[model samples]
Target: MDAFSEFIRGITRDNPILGLVLGLCPALAVTTSVENAIGMSVATAFVLVCSNVFISTLRKQIPSAVRLPIFIIIIATFVSIIRMVMEAYVPSMHAALGIFIPLIVVNCIIIGRAEAYASKNNVFFSFVDALGIAAGFLLVLVLIGGIREILGTGQIVAFGYTLLSLPINPAVTTMIMPPGAFLTIGIIMAVVNYQRAKKRAKGG
Candidate 1:
């Protein structure tokens, strides 16, 4: 039950994107389409979960003074693995995500989780936490990407299948640009914040 609670907490109560507001660079950069968003999410999830497990396993052995360097090395190793796998297989996604893929090594969400949760918890718990946080981040990425794609391009596709086609509007082109990404995420953050405030007021 404690682990389950931790899982839920990572997703909503402490979401890396919305609640903690970490990893915004990639969140905004690679979220132009659903496919790219999913790719980035999966890549980050792999790095986060694997790094957390390894960190948790070696928590005691890692000296406190050098923990940051150790964490970066571990994270870089996983990021390299992700980069290699994506380059060899999903070359399109690899190209679309571009530099952002390599930048995941420095993403605060990964490092923050390692320092805050993985460094203090058991391997199993850290894995659960990583999964939950990754899911939460993926959820936001998809939502943002879906909105941008549907409004900007008038279509939403998962893999090669079309999910929905919007009625075309000449004015909707803004959604495909940087300003739209900021606006979409800002509105979402506002809504989430409001709901949380309401829940707090009602003692939820």
Candidate 2:
């Protein structure tokens, strides 16, 4: 496939969350607020992109029997670097994200791409694929986070700014909980499925 098509496929047809259903743990865990969601997405993106490039570059040299271990090492190194950077610069976000930052090493999205795409593809396309998949992840996380934040707290606040607020507080704190994450993702999946079905019917 061409680079553009590959990139678009990651965002749409193969999205880790809304499409392929990968990486739900962090998706559901850190999306209570938009700020936390953004932080997680950025950290995950850094690891995904860096690991993809490194793995693709070393794919030929790495033995197939031990490729997975090498992939983990590469992923962990990037995750640790980002973790320390976040700790030093954005300590609050770093603390809020907590274990999830380190957990990115095992995130299916990263390992899956390393094995499935990066290991097989050239460096440039691997980079493109990571960017596309990361964008898709960010898209879903922010959508869920924004919905929960607005409904649960009657407003949306990120980076010390109120992007949205409702008159006469209508906060429903339940929307910030685990059940709310399930409900929000369920509704989103339904909508996505409906749209895809409609497009198929229209012969798109």
lDDT of candidates 1 onward, in order: 0.93, 0.94
Task: Give per-residue lDDT, candidate 2, residue 145.
Answer: 97
lDDT of 2 by residue, 63-169 (tens): 99999999999999999999999999999999998899999988999999999999999999999999999999999999999999999999999999999998636
Query: What TM-score, over all chains together, does every model reach?
Result: 0.97, 0.96
Residue 196 of model 1, lDDT score: 84
- RMSD values for the candidates in order, in angstroms, are 1.2, 1.2
Give each model's clash number: 0, 0
Task: Pick the lDDT winner.
Answer: 2
Tens digit per residue, CA lDDT, model 1, 59-93? 99999999999999999999999999999999988
Q: How does candidate 1 score on lDDT?
A: 0.93
